[model samples]
Every structure is written in structure tokens, then in C-alpha cells.
Target: MTTICVDVMGADKEPAVLLEGVAQALAADTDLEVLVAGAAEFVEPFAASHDRARALVTTEVITMSEHPAQAVRAKKDASIVRAAAAVRAGEADGLFSAGSTGAVLTAATFGVGRLKGIKRPALSLPFPGISGRPTVFLDMGANADVRPDVIVQFAQMGRAYARAVLGVAEPRVGLLCNGSEETKGSEMALAYHEALAAADCGFAGNAEGTDILAGTFDVIVADGFTGNVALKSIEGTGKFVLKRLKAAMGASLKNKIGMALLAGSLKSLAGELSGDEYGGAVLLGLRAPVLKGHGATSARAVCQGTLAAVRVVRAGLTEKIADACELSA
Candidate 1:
């Protein structure tokens, strides 16, 4: 059985909505055990309503609205910290949280630590590109700035993520830059581009923001600042398109017919492309896989994120990342 710890105190909706996800997951997978970290009394009612939720949940609720670090340090009972402890104690295979991004990151970093030789871990996001090919972008928001050597490590880790998660044979890596020209943008990007090329990597040269949407490379490497911008842009675009499509469908009789005929396909396609649907962004270059879901996640999103965590661990992503980094104890 796969065990997962969920931060119930995290997210905008609190434990109620989160319990829905836990219930849904438990009902779907008998082999899944959920460790809920929140107020146990609040969760008991929800658990009682569902048979599987009652049977599968191992109640362990942490308090709400406390500073994550201090709470983790002082309370030792905060939901996010307890979840991390669950992972550290080998009681849970992975931890999922939609809580304070800072708190979750801090607690996990302190509890799990980074893989050896990794300066700091990065968050890697995989976007479905043109032709359904997935491209990975790294350092989404872990560290705002990075050194040239760290950028190289990001590239290697991003490539490994693509290979394991996306099943690419030899993922092509590209440095995200302002322009494809060699002498474009800041000294940081140009210097890092040169470093990536020099390293023993399948560097595909430089790629611009435009190329990312056009599916230019298998992996996109950038510092957290630029990478976060690119990730938000893609997410914003998806939302805009979906909204416009819905409005168009409601405007006319012909459009209604078109929607009726294509609704199933559209739903499936949307499910495949959504960030929430794809589960969560992973904090890569760590000893264990850590998935960070949206703060406003739904039960479906949580379930998906848990499934993604299971797949990442089962695929041996951590070992592959350590091998790619060539770290020595």
C-alpha cells in the first residue's frame, strides 16, 4: 500500500474540502492510505459519512493559521510540519500540501534536506507542448537567484525529470533567454547558456519565450524569477482559452450543437492540460519526491497530485536525479 501525508490545514477551503479529496481517493484506491494533518474532530464527521474514508484515514490533524516554521519548531503539531515528519519517519511515502508555499518549502527543506551537492532544490513544472510533447521548466520559485553552477545542475535535473516523467529517450535541454542570438539578454543568461553547452548535456542551444509555446525543446532551464513568469503565463493562457471557449459555446445555437458534439473530447483534453488536473509541481533535486499542489485545489486536483507523487516515487525519480548530478557522499 502507498501512504501519503496531506496537510489538511493548508489551502483556502481548509479541511472540509480537503476531506472530500481524501474520501474520493480512498474510495477509488483501496491500496491508498491517507494521513490527514489537521484538527481530528473536524475530520471525524466527514470520515464517518464515507465508509472508505473512515477505514483508510489515519487521523493526525495539526492546528490552523500558525507560522509554519515556528509552528513546526515549537508546536511539533502543526499540520504541515507533522506531514513532513511523517515522510521523515518513513511513515508516509510522500507528502502533499496546498498550504503556505513558504511554510511547506521551509518545513520540507528542514526535515527532508536536499540531495548531496545540490545547493538548493528547485520546483520543476512540466507543460504539455505542441503535438502533446511535454517540456519541463525548472527553478520555478525555489530560489529567486542562482549561480552559474546551480543553473547547470538545474538543467541536468530538468532533463532527468523529463526522461522519467515524460519518458523521453534523450531529452533536449535549452536555456530560456530573451532571444536565440548568442549575445542577447543579461550577462547571467548568456554566461549560463555557454556553461550549459560546455557541460556534458544534450544542450539544444538557447530558446526564447516564444519558442516555449511552440515546443522548441524538451527541457527549459532558467532561474526562479523568469521560470515563475513563464509558468504563470502558460497557466493564464489556459484559463483564458477555456473561458473564451465556454462563452463561444453559449452564444449561439450552432455553437451549442458543436459543444454537444465535442464536449466529451473537450473535457478530456482540458483534463489532460490543466495544472490542477496534472496534480502538482514537484520540488526536484531532493532525496524524496515532494509535490506542491495549488493553494485553491479541489478534491480532484488533490487526488491527481497524490497519484502523480506515487508515480514519481515508483519511477525512481530521486535515484535518477542523484545519478544525473553524480553526487558523492
Candidate 2:
């Protein structure tokens, strides 16, 4: 059986909501078990009700505003910290949390540990594609600054994720930059371009912001700073477009008739665009797979995130990543 340690605290939503997600996950997978960590009021009842779930009964809660490393050090019984410990101790194969991103990353990196030879772990997510399959993007917010060599490793990691999770054979990799030209980037981007070109990993040259969702590249790598900015920009733009569309659809009776005709297709598109469908971001290059859901994630998102973690553990994602890194090295 694949067991995942779930941190049920530190999210914007109530603990009950996350618990409901956990219940949903349990109902979905018979081979899955969960070690839920949270306050006694929340976790005790959950564990008592679900035969597959066990409560860790954490006393402390880490808030989003606290310093990640420091809070992790001080709050030994914090939900996220204990959840990571469970993974490290072999009590769980992976971890899932809708907590502070920084706290989850810090705890998982330091507690669960990085894979051997991995210089830094990356935060990656598979983004829904426009015309083709979802593209795997990495360094979402792990390392704000990285060397050219690290960027190359990101390419290898991204490629491995594309194959293992997204089921892409021979995924093409790209470095995010201002322009598509090899000559069109900052010194770091140029260095990355040169390094990736020489690396064994699939290198498809530079990708612009417009190419992120254009189905032009299977994997895109960037430093955390740039990747985070680009991710937020895409999210914001999507929301903006969605709001405008809603307004336009409700503007006139003629538009309402048109909307009724396209309602089914629109709902399908919304599901694809919603981050919930993909679960959450996975921290690659770790000893075990660790996923972080959005702070305001819904119960469906949590359930999906738990299932995603299960898939990662069952696929032996960490072992595949280690082999990928070793081969590249």
C-alpha cells in the first residue's frame, strides 16, 4: 500500500475542508492510506472515522507569515514538519500539503532530505496545454538564483517528470527567455542555453512568454524568480480573461442564448484551466515526492493532490529522478 502524509493545517481554508478532501481521497483509492497531521479537534475525529487514516495529532501550527526555516526549527510538532518527518521515517512514501509554500519546501528539503547528487530541489507543475499535452515547467519558486549548471539539472529533472508523470516520450526541453534566439538572453540565459545545448537532456532552444502555453515545448526551465513571475502572470491573465468572458456572456439576452449553446464546452475548458484538475506542484529532486497545493485550495483540489502524490510514489518518481540525475552527471 502507498501511504501519504498529509498536513491538514496552515491553509487559507478551514481544516474541515482539507479533511473532507482526505476523506474523498480515501474513498477513491483502496490501496492508499494517510497519516494526517493537524490539531486534535480536527485530526482525532478524522482518524477515528477512516480506517485507512491515522492521526499524528500535532500541537503547533505554522502560519504563512512565519520565516520558513526558523519556524520549521522552532515548531517541532508543526503539521508540515511532522508530515515531512513521517515521509523521512518511512511511515509514509510521500507528502501532500496545502500549507505555506516556503514552510513546506524548507521542511521537506531539510527533513525528508534531497536525493544524492542533487544540488537543489525544484518545484514543478504540469501546466495544461492549449493544443497538445500538458507541459512540465520547473523551478516554480524553489531557488530564486541558480547557476548555469543548476539550470541544466533542471532540464534533466523536467524531462524526467515529463516522461514519468505526463507520459511524454522524448520530451523536448526549453529555457525560458526574452526571445527565441540563442543570442537573445541575459548573461545567465546565454550560459544556460550553451550548457543545455551541450547536455544530454533534450534541448529545444529558448522559449518566450508566449510559448509557455502555445504547445511549443514539453518542458520549460527557469530560475525561481522568473518562473514565479511568469506563473503569476499567466494565472492573472487567465482570471482576467475569464472575468471578461463572464461579463460579456451576461451582457445581453443574445449572448445568454449563445452561452447556453456553448455551456458544456465552456465548463470543460474551465475544468482544464482550473489548477484543481492538476492537483498541485511537486518538489522534484527530493528523497521522496512532496506536493504543495494552493493556500485556498478546494476539497477537490486536495483530493486530487493526494491522488497525485500516490501516483508519484507508486511510479517510483524519486528513484527515476535519481537515475536521471546520475546519468546526466
Candidate 3:
């Protein structure tokens, strides 16, 4: 059984909704075990109602709205800290927290430590691809300001993630930039591109923003600033398109019929694009598994995030990341 620790107080929704998600995950995977850190009174009842209150999961209950560092420090019994401690102690294979990205990162940093030669850790997000392949985007916000060398490390990290999550043997990697031209984007990007090209790790040259949704490569690397902008742009475009579709469908009966015919397919497609459906972002190049859930995550997202963490541990991503980082270094 893979033990996964989750910060139950992390999401915008409180223990109620998040705990409900824990229930959902438990229902989906009977072999899995979850250790929730949050209010025990809130979580215990939910566990008891399902009769899983006992052996399937244990509760640690940390409060919401606590300062990231202070909460982790002062709340010796805080859920998030306990979860991190669990990972450090080898009691859990991975940790998931939707509460605060900074807190989660800080806790994981202190709890798990960094991989050899990796100066900064990255957040890796998998985007749905064309032809059903998954594309990975790295440094999504783990480090806002990064050096050229760090971007190269991000590429290697992205490559390892694609291999582990997408099962691509030798994933093609591309640098995210304004244009495909060698001179486009930042000076740092140009230098990093040249570095990756020289290193020989399946680098696929540069990729423009337009190429991301088209899924041209298995991995796309960028500094946190560029990557976060690209991620938000894609997410915003998706939401905007859906809004327009809804408006169009409501305007007339013909459009309504059209939407009715396409609703199921559209839902499946949207699900594929949703961050929630992907579970959460993985903090790469760390000694232990650290999954960061979206702040707006619901119970389903928490449950799925825990599952994703399990897959990360099972993939032996920590070892893969260390190997990749050593090569990149």
C-alpha cells in the first residue's frame, strides 16, 4: 500500500468539502491509504460515516489561514507539518497540499530537501495533447526568478517528468518562447536553448505559445515567469471559449440542439484540459514527492492529487530526477 499524506486545510473549501474528496478517493482506490492533516473533529466524522473512519485513513487536522512558516512551525500538530513529517520519516511516500503553494514548497523544502546539484526545484504541469499525448510544462511557478542554468535544469526535469507520467521513452523537449526564431524572446532563453541543444537530451528546438495546445513536443521548458503566463493564458482561453460556447448555445434553439449533440464530447474535452482533472502540480527535483493542488481545488481535486502523488512515488521520480539533474549539472 502506498501511503499518501494530504493537507486537508489547503483548499478554499474547508474540511467538509475536502474531506468529502478524501472519501471519493478512498472509494476509487481501495488499496490506497490517505493521512489527512487538518481538524480531526471535522475529518473523523466523515471517516466514521463511511466506516473507513478507522484503518483506511488517519487524521492530523491543521487549521486554515495559518501563516505558512509559522503554521508549520508553531502548530506542532498542524496537519500540513505532520504530512511533511510523515514523508520525511518514511511513513508516507508522498505529500499533497492545496492550502498555500509557498507553505507547501517551504514545508517540502525543509522536510524533503533538494536533489543533488539542483539549486532550485520546479513545478511540473501536464497539459493535454493532440492525438491524446500529454505535454509537460515546467517551472510553472516554483521559482519566479531563475538563471539560465536553472532553465536548463528545468528542461531535464521536464524530460524526466514526461517519461514518468506520459511514459514517453525519449520525450522531445522544446523551449517556450515568443517566436521560433533563434533571436526571439529573452537573452536568457537564447542562451538556455543553445545550452540544451549542446547537451544532447532529445531537445526539440524552440516552441511558440501557439504550439503548446497543439502538443508538438512531450516536454516544454521555460522559466517560472514565462511558464506561469503561458499556463494562465491557456486556462483563460479555455474558460473564455467555454463561456462563448455557453452564450451561443443559449441564444437560439438550433445552437442548443447543436450543444446537446456535443455536450458529452465537450465535457470530456474540457475535463482533459482542466487543471483539477490533472490532480495537481508536482514539485520536481526533490528528495520526496510534493504535489501542489490548485488553491481552488475541490474534494475531487484533492483525492486525485493524492492519487497523482502515489503515481509519482511509484514512478521513482525522485531517483529519476536525481539522475537527470546530475546529467544536467
Which structure is stronger by TM-score: 1 or 2?
A: 2
Q: In angstroms, give how far residue 257 of model 3 lies from its true place.
A: 3.4
Candidate 3 accuracy as TM-score = 0.88
**Which ranges in model 2 have alpha carbons more than 4 Å from their true place?**
256-271, 327-329
Worst 10 residues of 2 by lDDT: 267-276
lDDT of 1 by residue, 239-328 (tens): 788788889998999988988898897776665555665677888876677888887778888878877777787778888888888886
Q: Per-model C-alpha lDDT, please?
A: 0.76, 0.90, 0.77
TM-score of 1: 0.85
Better of 2 and 3 by lDDT: 2
Please write out the lDDT profile of model 2 over residues 218-277, one tens digit for every residue: 999999989999988888887787778778888999987887888787766655555567
Rank order (by lDDT, best first): 2, 3, 1
Candidate that scores best on lDDT:
2
Clashing pairs in 3: 10-99, 37-79, 38-61, 38-62, 39-61
Off by over 4 Å in 3: 46-77, 327-329
Provide the clashing-pair count of each candidate structure.
Answer: 2, 0, 5
- TM value for model 2: 0.94
TM-score rank order: 2, 3, 1
Q: Runs in model 1 with CA error above 4 Å? A: 27-30, 42-75, 244-274
Q: Which 10 residues in a row give candidate 3 its minimum summed lDDT?
A: 52-61
